[model samples]
Target: MGNVRLRQLVIAAGSLDVADTLADVLGLGEAFLDPGVAEFGLVNRVYGIGDQFLEVVVPTALTAPAGRFLARGGDGGYMAIFQTDDLAGARARADALKFRRVWNIDLPDISASHLHPADVGAAIVSIDEARPAASWRWGGPDWERRAAPGKLTGAVITSAAPEQMAARWGEALGIPAKGGVIRLADATLDFGMGKEERMVKFQVSLPDVGAACIRAARRGLDVVNDEVRIGGVGIVLSG
Candidate 1:
């Protein structure tokens, strides 16, 4: 099997207005929507943060998956998306492990599989392989140009059974887990034992962390110990 890296992070927002507010607070560029998602009763805004993408989705219908997620966990990190070079190998591994697929898209140019959140023991995990590794259809054509200055380094998942969850993700993705950190080709996943199984924070490196904190403060988000809380998750800043 080839390598895999964290490429996208999806947040489930309580509403469209909250999603928009998050994008603005983070100094993210104007988000673009994928018309294809409307069929799933979801409306989303995708922001390219460096090479990685952050997507915030709200439900159009009360019965939509996004709506159910918001009701269960509120506005927070909903999914972790990984891009791999070997899609078939990944699928085979998942099959061997008997992981259930919640959603899937197989096309000539793109292959995506979303695993059930309950089975993953944290949030939704999405694995995808695009026809040209850099081409992200969900982000549209302008994603690269629209990428902001900051880079998202990794994500933190807090679970009641941290080691077990970490091992599950590590084994499923063929990554190595050490000291609560699962190291990937381009990013890392840190699992922490806590009272909840939720995404707690994301680390971002910017040209000026202080300036970013100031900008966030101006938007009514307080920065405590260089971390800003927004959309029910912490944004940890570093230079």
Candidate 2:
């Protein structure tokens, strides 16, 4: 098996309004509008978050899947993408586990398998591999060094049965979890008990939490210590 890293997390917002809000709060500027995603009746903008990326999709058509997702809540996490050096190995494991992949794409530069959320657990888990190692086509060109206020550090998945979901995810990805926690190269995935299973929160490491909180306050957003809820997700500013 190959080592995997949490490379990107996607949010489904009502519209680009949430993306605009996130750009201000995260100090992120570069946005890649992937034309390919329009086939899904959605508009996608990928922002460079340190070396990783953050993608936000807004449904355009009435029947878009994201539209159904937004109806449940407002805006929230829609998917999680993991970068694996050995995507083939991950796919083989998925087959053994009887995991169903809802979508798949293979290009000259990258290949991705989007697993069915119902089959996996909390959310849509995507395993992808990009050639030339560090090149991320989905994140746009030369985005690795883009400076941002903070970098994503972790994600929290709230599940009815936390340990089981964690184990299920680990099994499908070939990364065994210990007590509902999966450690990656630059971040961690924590599964905690909740009434429902969902991507409830994500962590960002900021150099100046106080300053960021002040900025958020200026925008009339509620900031309780290090966490601020905006763009349909709770951002824990880990200093």
Candidate 3:
């Protein structure tokens, strides 16, 4: 079986207006509010950065799954969703590794799966696959267009033991470790920042970080202008 590949990262928020504000400020297109595809919830939105996507999720009383995630995660951080060429094979590997499946959702056009934190030695790790029109498009109003000629920079994963955390990500993602980070063609996943009560940070490449921050701040988001760095790995707020 091949190692799981990092596909997308998610951030949970309290409202869609906030998400829309961030999207508009980022000069992202309309990837957020398209209804032709399945709408998970009113507060749930997504923006396509490149091959990978950044999602902003909001809990709704009507949507049990989103509500549950909000209740469990408490605030926000990096909510990872990995992609695999072979779903059954990946599941088999996870099973062999004794990872417990926490949530499983099978829609008409897509199948989403997740593993428990105990299994991955971190927060929830979700897996998904595109099924025809089931997958949503990346460019649209209220969405950030992929930074032309840009790629995913890196993601920060916090763990008590950085070396062990790196190894676990290596094993799960089927990538090799280099300088405490796993580098992919388009992105890097940094592991082992020490476990603490905080958020996971994802450092995405952008043409203009200052502009992004300005846009995010205008949307009533708590924008922190610190150069991207991870200690306990706090929630990533795209500016």
Model 3, residue 119: distance off in Å is: 1.7
TM-score of 3: 0.70
Taking all chains together, each candidate's TM-score versus the true structure is 0.95, 0.95, 0.70
Show the lowest summed lDDT stretch of 10 residues, model 2. 141-150
Which digits, one per residue and each the tens of the lDDT, describe model 1 over residues 1-239? 58888888888877777666667666788788888888878888898888888888878887988788778878888889999998788788888888888788998878999887787777889899999887888787778888777777899999988988998888678785787789888778999988989988888777788777888888887889999887788888888
The TM-score of predicted model 1 comes to: 0.95
Q: 202-227 in candidate 2: lDDT tens per residue?
A: 89887777877887888889998689
**lDDT at position 127, candidate 1:** 91
Give me the displacement of residue 25 in model 2, in angstroms.
0.8
lDDT tens per residue, model 3, 97-200:
77787767666656666776655665567766545422433334433344332234667777777667666556555566776687764567777565452237
- Sorted by lDDT (best first), the order is 2, 1, 3
Q: Cα deviation of 163 in candidate 3 (Å)? A: 2.6
Where does candidate 3 have its weakest 10-residue lDDT segment?
226-235
